[model samples]
Every structure is written in C-alpha cells, then in structure tokens.
Target: MSKTVTVSDQTGTEALAAQLAAVAKPGDVILMHGTLGMGKSAFCRAFIRAVANNPHEEVPSPTFTLVQIYELDRLPVWHFDLYRLSDPEEIHELDIEDAFADAVSLIEWPDRLEYLTPENRLDIHIEPGSNPDGRVFILEPSGDDWIKRIDQLSRDQA
Candidate 1:
C-alpha cells in the first residue's frame, strides 16, 4: 500500500521533510524517486537540515560528488546521487555498506542501486501536483519501521 501527500509549495515540502527527519534513526534508508527538477534535492536539503537541527546548514547536492557525508550530532547522514554513475558496481567505492549499517541514508536516482537496494526502505515517488509549486508524494514503505511511521503520518495528515 502507498500513501499520497500533496504539498503546496517548498515550505510544505520542508515541513514534511522535518516530520520525517524527527523520526529518522540510524540505519534508515530513504529512496527518492523523481525526474529532474522535481525537488528531490530540495526535499533532501530540508531533511538534512532538520535532522542536524540547523536551519542554515549548507546542504549541497551530491550530483557531481556522487555522495556527501554529514557527521551530525545524532548520527551520520550519507546522501548519494547516482545520476552520473554508469554502473552500479561503482557504488562500492563510496563505502555505502558502512552507511547502510550505521547512518541514515538518503538516495537520489536510486534505480542505479539495482541489486544493492536494501530490503527495508521507504520509497517516495514525487510528481507534479495541481500547481506549479505543488508536488504529490506517493510513499511506499516496505519495512515495519516505515509502515508504522507512514501510517501515523497518514492519520496526522488527515
């Protein structure tokens, strides 16, 4: 099952990200799905900032860098962008296994992960909504950890 959330603007996206960040813990993996300009980076920026409890922190996209690691007070955050990756095997160089075991990971262009994708994860598909700034999030949570949180979030949104 999936839950859909509609956000009117960037602020709405940030608010949603904040909610997730508050509940996120080590070993949590969030797989982001969307096309170019769909605000995946924007959502991640907000999520990392909220998790770090810093509103002014610089959250840059890992597009060229491939991955960005942030050592926050709680735990590390590994943000991965696999758009430029030509092969999934290249992920080995990023030491993603460590992030999988100990940190909270947010991935963009996760399709590149292929067989390496974790079994327990929350997959969020972003699509354009009614307005220019609006976005519709279709959340598919696979693990118990995510199902419970997403269920609560559904009720909260209701």
Candidate 2:
C-alpha cells in the first residue's frame, strides 16, 4: 500500500519526520530513494534528530562512511547511504543483516540492495514538487504493519 505527503519547506519535512518517529520502532526498515539534491539527506537528518530527541543534534549524511550508527534512548538507529556502493556484496560486509532484527534502519539508495532488501520494509520515494522548496514523499509499505500505521497517519493528518 502507498501514501503520499507533500511538504513545502524544511520545517514541513521535519514535521513529517517527527510524525513518523512517533510510530517508529526497533526492527523497522525505511528505504529512501531519490535523485541527488532531493530532500533525502534533509529528511534523514530530521528523522535522526527526532529519534535522538535532540533537535540540535548534528547528524551528517553517511554518504562516505556507508553506515552511521546512533544509539537513541528508545532504540538504536542504523543510517546507511548505499549510493557509493561498488557492489551489492559490500552490503554483507557492513553487517546490516544484524540491524534488521534490532535497530531502526534508514537506508538511502536502497535500490542498490536489489534482492537483499527485506520483505517487510517501507519504501519512501521523494521528488520535487511544483513549488520551489516543495517536496513530495511517496510512501509504499511492504507489510501489513506499516499499512496500519499509514492508515493511522492518514487519520491523524485528516
């Protein structure tokens, strides 16, 4: 199932992230897909700050490091940027399999994972909106759990 949310600026994007944070938990995997200059990094930064419970926390993009782990009060977060991955085999080296069981994972360029992606995951595709500084988030859930959460989000937004 899928849902779409449109935001007009950074604050709107962050607000959406914070709403997701309210329902996020350990073992959740969110795959982020978007072209460069899209708001993937900004969204991830906001999500990370929300999870960390520190609005001012400095959460850098994991573009070069591949994966950055953050220990939050409620659950650990595994942020992965697979854009620079040379091969899918490299994913095994990062031990992401372990993150899927206990941590909340936010992955960028998850298309690089190919078949390695979990069956129960959330796919978030972002794109530029019609207005300047606007963004559209296309959320597709791979499992019933996320579908229910999305429904709740819809009701809340309504």
**Best-performing candidate as measured by TM-score:** 1
lDDT of each residue in 21-140, candidate 2, tens digit only: 889999999999999989888898899899888999889889899999998897889999999997899999999998999999999999899889999998999989767788888889
List candidate 2 stretches off by more than 4 Å.
Answer: 155-158
Q: Estimate each model's TM-score.
A: 0.96, 0.95
Clashing pairs for predicted structure model 1, backbone only: none
Cα displacement (Å) at residue 143, model 1: 1.0
RMSD of each: 1.4, 1.7
Distance (Å) between predicted and true CA of 86, model 1? 0.9
lDDT of 1 by residue, 34-89 (tens): 99999999999999999889999999889999999999997789999999998999
- lDDT for each of the candidates? 0.91, 0.88
